[model samples]
Target: MEEDIAEIPHYKYYFATFKELEDKVDQIELLSDVIGVVTIVQDLEKSTLNSRITSCRNVTIKNVENKELQVTLWGHKTDLFDDNVLKTLEGPVVTIFTSVLVKKSLGKPRLSSTTSTLFFVNPNIPKVEDLKTRFQEDVKTIKFLPSAITTQSSLNEEKKENRKTLVKLLEIRPKSTKDMRFTVKAVIVDICEKDGWYYMACPNCMPPVSQADVSWWCQKDSFINKSPLAWYKLNTIISNQTGKMRMMIYGRVAEYLIKEPCIQLVTNHVNQDKRKFPQAIIDVIGKYKIFQIAFETKAIDNVAICKKVFDDETSEATNNRHRLSPPINPKTPDPKVSVNQR
Candidate 1:
């Protein structure tokens, strides 16, 4: 058997770069092979799939081009990664994943392992050695920074000493049209169903896409020959005792309340009445949440966009106790606040 395998011709390999895979992120008709230097390996996680629990893990890989792509290993594939051994290995760890299908989660594209997928780490192959050499050369010129989420959270904790009421939030004027981030405590007073509950989004960039004949199209990429993903684009009125603000709760923030993927909701909603909002969305009407809102100054409309949503816990008391610091420009008006009737 070993002799027979050795006599077989060397398999012709075609590896994709991070850029190519990202551009056709919504395409899964063909499987792909990817090679990169292992930069970050996440812990094994478990989730329910088809009524059974399954294990998976994600690792961030960087190509010689210094572009990062996340590869997710599922089921038995997760065991192929020897975490302890990889941690102890010296120099850059060249890893390869074969026969992966592209999938999108929360609007970001990632490689998902199929049943035929193979995992390799530092294999005795010429391609890996060449990649390792190039990656090592590039690493010298690169300065790594902390993950964006970690950095943003640290900055928010530093500057977000107090949460603002809707009234105070409206009082502050931005220096420019650039979006300003703020944390607020508010209750969902009503769900705005004017534009329906969700949108068909481009799987790569998460922007709304329209169906153009057989293909889905968006302004960013023109026509994408891939199925668009249904993502949450919830509009609602949120209020504290001070005032109410029209807010847009998008993507995962809306998913956090709906407790289901927008794709599933879209499937069920296709035949349903178009005038009514999904029950899952309606259920959150009276719920209170701590929202990290982004105020877009360029828009003439008075709507606060929600970036992150948190559970109302001890933060509510802290919000009421402390006042929002004066705006960036003290000349900004501090208008008398009035509560809006629900």
Candidate 2:
């Protein structure tokens, strides 16, 4: 039996580049294999999906060309991470994820492990050694940009002393330079499709990349020849009785409102005119909800940014509570600014 096993052929791997996998994001039936240097591994987390709880972990990897991509491990795959060995390693760790399902989040192409997905950390292969050598030579220059979601969560929360109206929010200037948060009530008056629905961004830095003659150019990182990530940068015109304002919704927030991923929408409507808005986005033109907005004091083009959106149930409950509360005093300003709940 041992002699028979030794005579069997070794397993073969066919790895795909970041560009190749991104092009096949919408092909749900296709599976891909990827290999890169493990740059960041997040702590194990529990999340509910499909009405059931599951263990998941995110691992960020970069290829020899300095292109980064995120891969999520689900179920028992999360236990394959050996933290002790990773921490004690003197060199960069290279991993190969096979038979992964390519998916998109906020326009960025990511991989999710399927039932057949398998991974190897620091696998003994010539390609892995080549990746390790490249990483060692460029370790100091390989700084991954902080995720926008992470930065938004780290921002200081503002006290809900007053719910600002659309007009009031514009008039007030924050004292500090840091981002200031505010709660506001508004309705989606129109979808601003002038900038389209999404933009291609650098996978590592998250900066919007411009299309060069033959490759994508990122101002911070210069020319990156690999495939760029598509992130949701949907803009909408929101309004209240006080006034109207243009608010920017990014990434997951846009996903929450649209109930769809940007990549999927783009793929499904690839033949449609770019100027025309997709039906998924157009459906939210009349939604009335509460938005937690983040105002950047120094921003030139961006006036207001929506962080978290309250659902219909939460918005209605808050409205009811406000109507039942009596006024504190005739001289006191109205703490709650009411808007049409259509």
Candidate 3:
């Protein structure tokens, strides 16, 4: 019985990363044709809309070539096996069911001891390679693919263009100051956002200010009767093999992208209307059509670079600085006492 089980043909496996998997995915025979061991497990509790109904455990598996494949596990298997199976099982295989694509994509994979689709543990599996040459060649092919942006620009120049929209995330870095305005452009690996505003500072003195009651204060004067205004500052950092550069953009140009009404809300006190605060910020930030998707990049998208003003505002050190003076002489401590007592 054991020998017959070992002879049975299981799902064919593909050894590739998620990117590679996406590329050659069409060549895959069927959803049922793919299988591999779970290599990584992700917790999806925080982000999803239906947090209650779904299991948080999602698995990522590495095939023979060390390519990662994300799998969602669900049903009875959620209760049967703990996450420790990933560490303990030398080989845990899963069989794919093509007809089950709808639900399979929704939940993580479940393991069953008897089912061919599920392998509790199997010792026999191939070693993963460092890199797949075939994947590298395919990437090279994609690199030469024609861009629609290029085509659109040519058509516009010839006056033969129709109404068409192009959506792209462009990173702009200040190359140099021209006519008192900074010139910038998109560069690879440099962070960029489409429609976000930087905390506005005064152009004359470049001072940052919080919302004042029904007014805004500059260094010497208060601009009263002015609708609460938040200045949008375009923040960008450009880095390449040569070096890195940081730029802060201001004036009417920044106002055009961020808009006036949204900026007013950021600078105003909306305490009584607490719900509007978060949504207002999101609306202002989201207007930037091209956003760097990664969280790390997004965090610094609209940051303001300003100088610290006062010495008292400095951060204090936690370590003790005082040192006691040592005794003048080892035997001279008996000034107040008798020589016999010493």
Per-candidate clash tally: 0, 1, 13
- What value of lDDT does candidate 2 attain over all alpha carbons? 0.73
Q: Cα RMSD to native, each candidate?
A: 12.3, 12.5, 23.5
Per-residue CA lDDT of model 1 for 93-158, tens digit only, reads: 888888898876776769988888987788878877887787775543222223223233454463
Model 1, which residues run further than 4 Å from truth? 5-15, 22-33, 37-83, 87-92, 97-120, 123-162, 172-177, 315-342
State how far residue 81 of model 1 sits from its true place (Å): 5.7
Per-residue lDDT for 1-342 in model 2, tens only? 776674442557889989998766744446888999888877777653322346777888999889999988888888876555666666678889999988889998999988888888777788999998998855522233332232212221322324689888777664442555777877777677678788877764667999899898999989986677667887788887899988988876887788887778878975556557877887776667778787776775447888776554445554443332334675654547454531
TM-score of each: 0.61, 0.51, 0.24
Q: Which residue pairs of candidate 1 clash?
A: none
Native-to-model Cα distance after best TM-score fit, residue 23 in candidate 3, in Å: 7.0
Write the number of the candidate with greater TM-score, choosing between 1 and 2.
1
Worst 10 residues of 1 by lDDT: 141-150
Selected candidate, larger lDDT, 1 vs 3: 1
- What lDDT would each prediction earn against the true structure? 0.72, 0.73, 0.34
Q: Which window of 10 residues has the lowest lDDT sum in candidate 3? A: 306-315
Best by TM-score: 1
* Worst 10 contiguous positions by lDDT, candidate 2: 150-159
